[model samples]
Target chain A: MVPLYWYLWLGSVVFAVGIFGFLTRRNIIIMFLSIELMLNGVNISLVALSHYMQDLRGQILVFFVIAVAAAEAAIGLAIIIAMFRNKATLHADEIAEMKG
Target chain B: MVEWFFGYLAGAVILLSILVVLSRNPVHSVLWMLLMFLHVAGLYLLLNAEFLAATQVIVYAGAILVLFLFVVMLLNLKEELRIKRFTGGWPFRLLIAAGILIILKKVLDGFKVGFKGPWSIEAIEQATHTKALGKVLFTEYILPFEIASLILLVAIIGAVFLAKKRLRT
Candidate 1:
């Protein structure tokens, strides 16, 4: 009914902001959030494109993306916790040493 | 009027997403991320992807984000949190973002793709995007899907191994 371009435009803006967040934030959790934002942005675009193209493929991809995102979240948060237990800091800059 | 509603919803979601990125408090950020997910789910509904909208809500808002919040609170990181800026300066960051926006505009402008009209909700109500998607995924994309699941299993085990010092003998 309304213009599809609007969704795409919004998606792109959100995605860009997410990119900026991912690049800028020094905190690992915040960076993880930026990643989530980026993923959400991509999902928005995928769903929008699927709707416009009358294709189901994009939606399917979103499904896979969500699954991967879940697995990523689990592994990432676990790693963050493990790191925090030893370093007592979550900031990316402070925890430079990966091995200890 | 409806278009205006959708526009506002989209804007709110984007704003919430920005808050998620900018908030210093991880708890707040996770909440904002949840709202963003909900807003995207609404967008999916608008796009006639009902099943996707539902799955998006259930998977992201209900599960993944909750896991994030749990981790944030479990660590009780508020005490040792660092209030650090993203980059050198906000103004400089904004300027760089603007430059990036301009470049993106230039890159995407030349690409001309024709738009097909929107699909009616009623037309898709019969078969449902979920059913159709399931059929396609199982029929055509079954192998990749299974592989992805296996990868996730491996990741799950790897996470356990990584987090725990040692496995039971």
Candidate 2:
């Protein structure tokens, strides 16, 4: 079997990719997807650690994180929809109207 | 054969994830993400966290991603997502991402790593994840669990309140 650190490497790579996507993407929805990617990356590491440590606390934490992620997505999407109604575009660049 | 299978699966998952990240169409990206989630669930099974694997599918695939698909459809964003556009950051962000990966690789490589705890493949076989995890969670982590549930409940209420358009007059 491969070492546990290898899993950590995979998780970190995914996390970095997610971070890059979030930073580069203009669309709010894509940004949300990137956040999900980061969360899933963390989930992978957590579950791996849980398995390796022979503990369930990590899994339990994942449960809570998932709950929070769902709630955040719901509320964020609602806000996005509201904004879309008032504004024609979903591009973050288009949000410059708020500039002081 | 095992190594080949793992390699292929990992490659497929990564490819789908990249597609999910790059695809302009939100619906297509969401579908790709669903596939990526399924692959991740498979990875959990390979890690021997069967209970976690099931939860990954049920919670992530069944619930979270479904919600994403719903919002994508509800917003009627198919044409809107097709507009070819990007944020302010372009090639610079990718350069930084590569730099971070390289630095991380070097740091991780420098560590003299050994599994300090009982993490053998054989040791994992004896420990039932669901049973052992339940025992610990209920006995030691009970307080934390209750606290988390309470917080989630409050968040749920907050979400409902925020989603409401107007106060009843």
Best candidate according to TM-score: 1
Predicted complex 1: DockQ: 0.57
The TM-score obtained by model 1 is 0.90
Candidate 1: segments with Cα more than 4 A from true spot = A98-100, B89-93, B114-123, B166-169
RMSD of 1: 2.8
Q: Can you tell me the CAPRI class of model 1?
A: medium
lDDT of 2: 0.75
What is the lDDT for B158 in model 2? 69
Which has the greatest DockQ?
Answer: 1
**Residue-by-residue lDDT tens digits, candidate 1, B1-67:** 7697798789898789889878878888889888888888888888888888889889889999998
Local lDDT at B28 for model 2: 87
Candidate 1's iRMSD: 2.6
C-alpha lDDT (0 to 100) for residue B7 of candidate 1: 84
Residue B129 lDDT, candidate 2, scale 0-100: 64
Q: What DockQ, between 0 and 1, does each candidate earn?
A: 0.57, 0.50
- Cα TM-score per model: 0.90, 0.87
